[model samples]
Target: MNCQTLLIDDAPAVRLQGAAGDTVTVLLRGAQVISWVDASGVERLYCSPASPLKGPQAVRGGVPVIFPQFAARGSLMRHGWARMRGWTLQPWDTSAPEPSVSLQLHNAVGDDPQWPHACVCTLTVSLLPNGLRMALTVENTGPASFSFHAALHTYLAVGDVAQTTLAGVLPEGAVLSLREPIDQIFEAVTGPLQLHSPLGLLRLEHAGFGDVVVWNPGPDAGLADLPPLGHTAFACVEAAAVMQPVALAPGAHWQGSQTLLSGL
Candidate 1:
């Protein structure tokens, strides 16, 4: 296992390499996992090249940590402030069998005034053989209770979005194929999901999340952060708890995770 600090577009980032040639790169800006390469050197996550790497803006792709809120459903900023705030890197065990790193956010002070709450959030990314696992834990340290929603907004790389098929615990032989724009939230997702694309087979498993969000903007969405035809190369399959907000009392904590297995 090896770890190195590198800069992407002048922003500080950490790259963790496993002995098997798999690697994961995490950015300090949002504690985002921007890249994941399998042992065969194939990138498994899609990150937009046109997205801004610096500042108060979130990166366009990769696994974005959505916290406190989801979308425009709250009074706070869309997706909350965790994805825009810088996080401090936590020390990890270098002697571990697999490469792993953790980043933490102490949201006690200097957070959004509208959502006043003292909380701590940590994101840990661990590299596996031809796979990656991300875990998010949130702890409330204030005297009052608070409710919030969160998700691991994961963007999966594909050879072509039109040629991809996603399968869950659906009707027999029924799978989702993205040929047009789609933004659907699935509730009570208790089973694993399989994504079959031209690149290969990938499996997604989630824990402590009740919902799964499948999204693709198609070709005409015209997102400023994405290049033209960029929509053809990726799909968003997120593990989320959005419909039901989680309430944590003072001194309470909660955790959720999403794992991705490539070439499976």
Candidate 2:
């Protein structure tokens, strides 16, 4: 494992790299992955330069950690508090099988008025020859059972959103009609999925999470926080638990991952 430190808005970040030239960059703020580049030096994840580099505000792109809640459908605010707060870097064994770094978030570290649950979240980023992988493990530390949704909210770059196709249950390379904005969640999917993009072919594979979320905020999304014209550069194809929240008893834990690999 290889680790390097850099700064974004004076906030410390870590970069992990593999022998094949695969790289993953993570910011300590929210433990958010700001970049992922495969061998050959092609950026695989999309993080708009317009996005907020410093938080308490969520960065508008890349693989942001969404934990304890997936969206506004909960008592907490939209997408929960994990993405908006800072995280601590943990001591990682560089001798691990892959280039990896881990970040952790625990309730004692901060205060969120609406969410009072005691929990711990661990996010690990790694580099492999053909893919960039992320694993999120959440543990319930409270005395009672609690349920929540989580996702690796990934914003993938595309040359033209209208030219992208998410290969799915449809046949003969049936296209995912991009004529309109897409904001939908797919549940109970079994395995890997391939997304054909203007950038390249992106393959997403996950386990422990059963729902797949795809979203594209067209010109009419009207989100005041979104960067101007930011919607045009990427598509969100995520690994999530949105259809149903995962329930964890006291001391119990759950884990999920999303691996992205691209080929031109």
Give the per-residue lDDT of model 1 (tens digit) for 180-232.
Answer: 78999988888699999999999999999999999999988989899999999
- In order, candidate lDDTs are 0.90, 0.82
Worst 10 residues of 2 by lDDT: 169-178
lDDT of 2 by residue, 1-264 (tens): 567889877768988888886788899988899888888787877887755677657888888898878888888878988887888899977677877899998884237667767899999888877888899999988887878899999988876777777875244545575446899887886557788766788888998888988889998877666766768778898899988899999999999999887763
Which structure among the candidates has the greatest lDDT?
1
Off by over 4 Å in 1: 95-97, 169-173
In candidate 1, the residue pairs with backbone N, CA or C atoms under 3 Å apart (3 or more residues apart, or in different chains) clash, namely none
* Residue 77 lDDT, candidate 1, scale 0-100: 85
Q: Pick the candidate with the highest TM-score.
A: 1
